[model samples]
Target: MEFHYHRTGPSPDLATIEQAIAQLDPAVLVDADDFARVRISTVLDEYALLDCLWRAGVQVAMGELERQPSVCCGGCGG
Candidate 1:
Protein backbone atom coordinates (compact mmCIF):
# COMPACT_ATOMS: atom_id res chain seq x y z
CA MET A 1 0.00 0.00 0.00
CA GLU A 2 1.05 3.58 -0.68
CA PHE A 3 0.29 6.43 1.68
CA HIS A 4 0.07 10.03 0.49
CA TYR A 5 0.09 12.64 3.23
CA HIS A 6 -1.20 16.08 2.39
CA ARG A 7 0.01 19.02 4.42
CA THR A 8 -2.51 21.67 5.41
CA GLY A 9 -0.35 23.89 7.54
CA PRO A 10 3.20 23.81 8.85
CA SER A 11 5.05 20.73 7.71
CA PRO A 12 5.48 17.85 10.09
CA ASP A 13 8.94 16.51 10.82
CA LEU A 14 9.93 14.10 8.08
CA ALA A 15 12.42 12.33 10.28
CA THR A 16 9.75 11.73 12.86
CA ILE A 17 7.42 10.40 10.21
CA GLU A 18 10.13 8.09 8.96
CA GLN A 19 10.72 6.79 12.43
CA ALA A 20 7.05 6.20 12.98
CA ILE A 21 6.75 4.26 9.75
CA ALA A 22 9.81 2.24 10.64
CA GLN A 23 7.93 0.77 13.56
CA LEU A 24 5.89 -1.23 11.08
CA ASP A 25 8.83 -3.43 10.08
CA PRO A 26 7.85 -4.02 6.46
CA ALA A 27 6.91 -0.45 5.72
CA VAL A 28 9.36 1.51 3.57
CA LEU A 29 9.61 5.12 2.62
CA VAL A 30 9.53 4.83 -1.14
CA ASP A 31 9.50 8.55 -1.96
CA ALA A 32 8.47 11.94 -0.75
CA ASP A 33 7.78 15.35 -2.30
CA ASP A 34 9.19 18.02 -0.04
CA PHE A 35 6.55 18.66 2.63
CA ALA A 36 3.48 18.28 0.49
CA ARG A 37 3.31 14.49 0.21
CA VAL A 38 4.86 11.18 1.20
CA ARG A 39 4.77 7.82 -0.50
CA ILE A 40 5.26 4.73 1.60
CA SER A 41 4.99 1.11 0.60
CA THR A 42 4.00 -1.44 3.18
CA VAL A 43 2.49 -4.84 3.68
CA LEU A 44 0.45 -3.67 6.62
CA ASP A 45 -3.22 -2.93 6.05
CA GLU A 46 -4.52 0.63 5.92
CA TYR A 47 -6.04 0.45 9.41
CA ALA A 48 -2.77 -0.68 10.92
CA LEU A 49 -0.88 1.97 8.98
CA LEU A 50 -3.25 4.72 10.04
CA ASP A 51 -3.14 3.61 13.66
CA CYS A 52 0.62 3.70 13.65
CA LEU A 53 0.60 7.20 12.25
CA TRP A 54 -1.95 8.38 14.75
CA ARG A 55 -0.08 6.89 17.66
CA ALA A 56 3.02 8.68 16.50
CA GLY A 57 1.16 11.99 16.30
CA VAL A 58 1.01 12.21 12.53
CA GLN A 59 -2.17 14.02 11.63
CA VAL A 60 -3.60 13.20 8.21
CA ALA A 61 -6.83 14.33 6.73
CA MET A 62 -9.44 11.71 5.80
CA GLY A 63 -9.22 12.49 2.09
CA GLU A 64 -5.43 12.63 2.11
CA LEU A 65 -5.14 8.91 2.56
CA GLU A 66 -5.00 7.34 -0.88
CA ARG A 67 -4.39 3.88 -2.25
CA GLN A 68 -1.90 3.83 -5.08
CA PRO A 69 -1.30 1.15 -7.66
CA SER A 70 1.61 -1.06 -6.85
CA VAL A 71 4.60 -1.10 -9.16
CA CYS A 72 5.15 -4.78 -9.11
CA CYS A 73 6.59 -7.24 -11.60
CA GLY A 74 3.46 -9.41 -11.19
CA GLY A 75 5.61 -12.36 -10.41
CA CYS A 76 5.01 -12.50 -6.63
CA GLY A 77 1.39 -11.41 -6.51
CA GLY A 78 2.24 -8.24 -4.61
Candidate 2:
Protein backbone atom coordinates (compact mmCIF):
# COMPACT_ATOMS: atom_id res chain seq x y z
CA MET A 1 0.00 0.00 0.00
CA GLU A 2 0.97 3.63 -0.58
CA PHE A 3 0.98 6.45 1.93
CA HIS A 4 1.59 10.20 1.95
CA TYR A 5 3.80 11.42 4.78
CA HIS A 6 3.56 15.14 5.50
CA ARG A 7 6.03 17.27 7.31
CA THR A 8 5.62 20.51 9.19
CA GLY A 9 8.33 22.29 7.25
CA PRO A 10 10.96 21.19 4.79
CA SER A 11 10.80 17.50 4.06
CA PRO A 12 13.32 15.17 5.57
CA ASP A 13 16.26 13.85 3.62
CA LEU A 14 16.07 10.66 1.57
CA ALA A 15 18.48 8.81 3.78
CA THR A 16 16.41 9.62 6.82
CA ILE A 17 13.21 8.30 5.23
CA GLU A 18 15.00 5.28 3.86
CA GLN A 19 16.31 4.44 7.29
CA ALA A 20 12.81 4.62 8.65
CA ILE A 21 11.37 2.45 5.91
CA ALA A 22 14.00 -0.11 6.71
CA GLN A 23 12.70 -0.43 10.21
CA LEU A 24 9.28 -1.43 8.97
CA ASP A 25 8.64 -5.00 7.98
CA PRO A 26 9.26 -5.39 4.27
CA ALA A 27 8.34 -1.84 3.31
CA VAL A 28 9.78 -0.98 -0.07
CA LEU A 29 9.83 2.56 -1.38
CA VAL A 30 8.43 2.69 -4.89
CA ASP A 31 8.84 6.44 -5.52
CA ALA A 32 9.11 9.80 -3.89
CA ASP A 33 8.45 13.48 -4.68
CA ASP A 34 11.27 15.36 -3.09
CA PHE A 35 11.00 15.14 0.70
CA ALA A 36 7.33 15.99 0.89
CA ARG A 37 5.81 12.85 -0.55
CA VAL A 38 6.71 9.19 -0.89
CA ARG A 39 5.24 6.01 -2.36
CA ILE A 40 5.87 2.69 -0.68
CA SER A 41 4.95 -0.97 -1.10
CA THR A 42 4.63 -3.27 1.88
CA VAL A 43 3.03 -6.49 3.03
CA LEU A 44 2.46 -5.52 6.66
CA ASP A 45 -1.11 -5.57 7.87
CA GLU A 46 -3.12 -3.23 10.15
CA TYR A 47 -1.26 -0.10 9.06
CA ALA A 48 1.83 -1.11 10.97
CA LEU A 49 3.85 0.84 8.44
CA LEU A 50 2.30 4.06 9.70
CA ASP A 51 3.51 3.24 13.17
CA CYS A 52 6.99 2.73 11.89
CA LEU A 53 6.94 6.08 10.09
CA TRP A 54 5.62 7.78 13.16
CA ARG A 55 8.41 6.41 15.26
CA ALA A 56 10.82 7.64 12.65
CA GLY A 57 9.49 11.19 13.03
CA VAL A 58 7.40 11.08 9.89
CA GLN A 59 3.72 11.89 10.07
CA VAL A 60 1.74 9.90 7.56
CA ALA A 61 -1.66 11.08 6.43
CA MET A 62 -4.70 8.96 7.16
CA GLY A 63 -5.86 6.48 4.50
CA GLU A 64 -3.72 4.65 2.01
CA LEU A 65 -2.68 6.45 -1.15
CA GLU A 66 -3.92 5.13 -4.48
CA ARG A 67 -1.62 3.72 -7.14
CA GLN A 68 -2.05 2.68 -10.75
CA PRO A 69 -2.65 -1.01 -11.30
CA SER A 70 0.30 -2.95 -12.63
CA VAL A 71 -0.01 -4.37 -16.16
CA CYS A 72 3.12 -6.48 -16.22
CA CYS A 73 2.49 -10.20 -16.50
CA GLY A 74 5.23 -12.44 -15.23
CA GLY A 75 4.20 -16.08 -15.53
CA CYS A 76 1.79 -16.29 -12.63
CA GLY A 77 0.09 -19.43 -13.86
CA GLY A 78 -1.77 -17.36 -16.41
Candidate 3:
Protein backbone atom coordinates (compact mmCIF):
# COMPACT_ATOMS: atom_id res chain seq x y z
CA MET A 1 0.00 0.00 0.00
CA GLU A 2 3.04 2.17 -0.28
CA PHE A 3 2.46 5.18 -2.53
CA HIS A 4 5.09 7.27 -4.27
CA TYR A 5 4.64 10.31 -6.46
CA HIS A 6 6.42 13.46 -7.47
CA ARG A 7 6.22 16.24 -4.91
CA THR A 8 7.68 19.10 -6.89
CA GLY A 9 6.10 18.00 -10.12
CA PRO A 10 2.39 17.62 -10.78
CA SER A 11 1.24 15.43 -7.93
CA PRO A 12 -0.97 12.44 -8.14
CA ASP A 13 -4.45 13.67 -7.39
CA LEU A 14 -5.37 12.39 -3.94
CA ALA A 15 -9.03 11.98 -4.75
CA THR A 16 -8.30 10.30 -8.03
CA ILE A 17 -5.80 7.97 -6.45
CA GLU A 18 -8.22 7.22 -3.62
CA GLN A 19 -11.08 6.66 -6.01
CA ALA A 20 -8.89 4.42 -8.08
CA ILE A 21 -7.93 2.58 -4.92
CA ALA A 22 -11.58 2.29 -3.96
CA GLN A 23 -12.55 1.01 -7.41
CA LEU A 24 -9.84 -1.56 -6.99
CA ASP A 25 -10.87 -2.61 -3.52
CA PRO A 26 -13.38 -5.47 -3.55
CA ALA A 27 -14.26 -5.61 0.13
CA VAL A 28 -12.67 -2.45 1.47
CA LEU A 29 -9.90 -4.30 3.21
CA VAL A 30 -8.04 -1.06 3.68
CA ASP A 31 -6.07 -1.88 6.78
CA ALA A 32 -4.88 0.92 9.02
CA ASP A 33 -1.42 0.77 7.50
CA ASP A 34 -2.76 1.05 3.98
CA PHE A 35 -5.23 3.71 5.00
CA ALA A 36 -2.49 5.64 6.74
CA ARG A 37 -0.34 5.34 3.66
CA VAL A 38 -3.19 6.80 1.63
CA ARG A 39 -3.72 9.51 4.18
CA ILE A 40 -0.01 10.22 4.08
CA SER A 41 0.60 9.60 0.41
CA THR A 42 3.03 12.46 0.16
CA VAL A 43 5.34 10.60 2.53
CA LEU A 44 4.40 7.13 1.46
CA ASP A 45 7.00 4.58 0.38
CA GLU A 46 9.53 6.81 2.13
CA TYR A 47 8.14 5.30 5.31
CA ALA A 48 7.29 1.66 5.70
CA LEU A 49 3.61 0.79 5.23
CA LEU A 50 3.67 -1.58 8.18
CA ASP A 51 4.93 1.18 10.39
CA CYS A 52 1.99 3.37 9.44
CA LEU A 53 -0.33 0.44 9.95
CA TRP A 54 1.19 -0.25 13.33
CA ARG A 55 0.82 3.36 14.36
CA ALA A 56 -2.77 3.29 13.17
CA GLY A 57 -3.38 -0.03 14.91
CA VAL A 58 -4.41 -1.82 11.73
CA GLN A 59 -3.90 -5.37 10.53
CA VAL A 60 -3.60 -6.89 7.10
CA ALA A 61 -3.34 -10.34 5.60
CA MET A 62 -0.63 -10.81 3.01
CA GLY A 63 -2.97 -12.52 0.57
CA GLU A 64 -5.69 -9.89 0.86
CA LEU A 65 -3.35 -7.04 0.02
CA GLU A 66 -3.29 -7.58 -3.72
CA ARG A 67 -5.95 -6.15 -6.02
CA GLN A 68 -8.77 -8.47 -6.85
CA PRO A 69 -9.20 -9.56 -10.43
CA SER A 70 -11.90 -8.06 -12.60
CA VAL A 71 -15.02 -10.15 -12.82
CA CYS A 72 -15.90 -10.82 -16.43
CA CYS A 73 -18.25 -13.55 -15.39
CA GLY A 74 -21.03 -11.17 -14.43
CA GLY A 75 -21.04 -12.24 -10.81
CA CYS A 76 -21.46 -15.82 -11.85
CA GLY A 77 -18.10 -16.76 -10.32
CA GLY A 78 -16.98 -18.01 -13.67
Most lDDT-accurate candidate: 1
Locate the minimum summed-lDDT window of 10 residues in model 2. 63-72
Q: How well is each residue in 1-78 modelled by candidate 3, as lDDT tens digits?
A: 333222233333444444434443432222223333333222233234434434443343333233333334557543
Model 3 lDDT on a 0 to 1 scale: 0.35
- Model 2 misses residue 7 by how many Å? 5.0
Which candidate would rank higher by lDDT, 1 or 2?
1
Candidate 2 lDDT, 1-78, residue by residue in tens: 444544457655656656666766444664567655666665544357667667667766556444435443767642
Candidate with more favorable, higher lDDT: 2 or 3: 2
User: Can you tell me which runs of candidate 1 are displaced by over 4 Å?
Assistant: 74-78
Give me the displacement of residue 40 in model 3, in angstroms.
7.0
Error of 3 at 41 (Å): 7.8
Error of 2 at 45 (Å): 3.7
Q: List the candidate numbers ranked by TM-score, top first.
A: 1, 2, 3
